[model samples]
Target: MTAVEYEENESKLMRKAKENPFVPAGILGCFAIVAYRLMKMKNRGDTKMSVHLIHMRVAAQGFVVGAMTLGVVYSMYKEYVLQPAAAQKALEQKTALEK
Candidate 1:
């Protein structure tokens, strides 16, 4: 095979081989946005003295809390887990190449 064809195939293999766990994390974030919009729409008629106002406030607070928790967890997982693992992999590759 030509050099260009070999490089192209190698890249395609790499692309398919890498499993990005962050894609689901991003989808979770998008889901939160959708949920927030839906909640707002559901409580659009809530007024200062309406019983629905309290429920709306509670729902919004819950959403905020949940979103914050998810963000913290995702960030901690990426920082404490994913990054180190990737760095170790790179180090191993470098060592192997130097051998």
Candidate 2:
């Protein structure tokens, strides 16, 4: 590909990376709420061991969801916020040197 094409592709990637952090946080937030609710239900003693077992399954599902959500949020924060801030600092230093 030409230089211009490469640059354009790179810029698109950077923009996507910058905008990607919210999805995981939103997912984690949802799971946390769900797990909390399930735990509450478990505490109510409205079900037998089998019922509690089902609640445990529900809790496990929530845990998996929360973990996956965390992974996404972390990826987004690192790619968009942290990496950009670091890159900006490096770019500023480079510009200072050029001047």
Candidate 3:
């Protein structure tokens, strides 16, 4: 493609990306895929498993599990705890305004 056409297309892609709600999740998934591939390559055989490799894998697994757990907890808090509180506050404000 010509330079101008490429630039126009790139700009359109950027604008679309800016509006995409899943961009963060997509980026995180890409990073996780790359990290998993790299870890596999690093641990490829011929060299017997060492203490360091085991520790590294354990740490990585812990990090992934911890992050997932945190995300679930935060989402639950927002949905069950925060939403009800917010709704109650809004209702109180509406009632006060009507008084």
Q: All candidates' TM-scores? A: 0.51, 0.50, 0.49
Kindly list the per-residue Cα lDDT of model 3 for residues 6-59, writing each as its tens digit.
Answer: 344466546534444244444465567557755676656575557546655665
Off by over 4 Å in 3: 1-51
| Among all candidates shown, the one with the greatest lDDT | 2
Pairs that collide in candidate 2 are none
Model 3 accuracy (lDDT, Cα): 0.62
Error of 3 at 46 (Å): 16
What lDDT score is found at residue 57 in candidate 3? 62
Candidate 1 vs candidate 2, lDDT winner: 2
Off by over 4 Å in 1: 1-50
- For residues 18-54, write the lDDT of model 2, one tens digit per residue: 4554444545666676667666774766567677657
- Please rank every candidate by lDDT, starting with the best: 2, 3, 1
Could you report the Cα RMSD, in angstroms, for every candidate shown?
A: 9.6, 9.6, 10.1
Give candidate 1's whole-model lDDT.
Answer: 0.61
User: Residue 68 error for model 1, in Å?
Assistant: 0.8
